[model samples]
Target: MSFQAYIDNIKAKTGKTPADFKKLAEKKGFIVKGELNPKTKATEVTNWLKEEFELGHGHAMAIYATFKGKTS
Candidate 1:
């Protein structure tokens, strides 16, 4: 699947855009001022996404990728 396809599926399943996830990530301290905190690990964010949002690994990683500045 294309990167956009993953993004679209995530939005359809969660009813949230990457922007929305970014905001939530900021609150969780995984992000700071639109940037991902260097101290944060991918697994931490992925696990949080999985537990809180019920996202599969790939979907969670997609969101984490957005946090890392993936826009395609």
Candidate 2:
């Protein structure tokens, strides 16, 4: 799925928008330097998403892809 599509799916699943997710990630220290770089490492992102958001692997991966700009 495209990045937008993944984000849309996340919204559907969590009832939160991409912007809201971004803010939550920021609060969790997942976002840094004003961007979520593709090279940030999946494990880190996955852990944060799982721990803070209680998202499953699929959903976390979708969030990762969106951050990496790889989904599209």
Candidate 3:
């Protein structure tokens, strides 16, 4: 699937936008000031996404990409 398609599907499934994920990631300390936290591992975020959000690897990675400033 395309990147935006993945994003759209995630939103459809989770009822959250990228901005909402960013807020949650910030609360989780996975990101700070709109960037991925240096002390946080990608797996940490991906794992949380998997467990808490029931997202697949690719879908979780898509959310992580947004943390890294992906928009397209």
lDDT for 36 (candidate 3): 91
What are the per-residue Cα lDDT tens digits for candidate 1 across 1-72? Answer: 888999999999999999999999999999997799999999999999999989999999999999998999
lDDT of 2 by residue, 1-72 (tens): 665776777788779875676677677566776478545688998887788778888778877766655545
Give the Cα-based TM-score of candidate 1 against the true structure. 0.96
TM-score of each: 0.96, 0.64, 0.95
Question: Which parts of model 2 have CA positions greater than 4 angstroms off?
Answer: 1-6, 37-39
Order the numbered candidates by lDDT, best leading. 1, 3, 2
- After superposition on all CA atoms, how large is the RMSD of candidate 3? 0.7
lDDT of each: 0.94, 0.72, 0.93
**For this target, which candidate reaches the highest lDDT against the unseen true structure?**
1
lDDT of 3 by residue, 40-67 (tens): 9889999999999999999999999999
Worst 10 residues of 3 by lDDT: 29-38
Question: What is the alpha-carbon lDDT for the whole of candidate 2?
Answer: 0.72
Better of 1 and 3 by TM-score: 1
Candidate 2, position 41, lDDT: 80
Model 3 accuracy (lDDT, Cα): 0.93
- Position 11, candidate 1: lDDT: 94
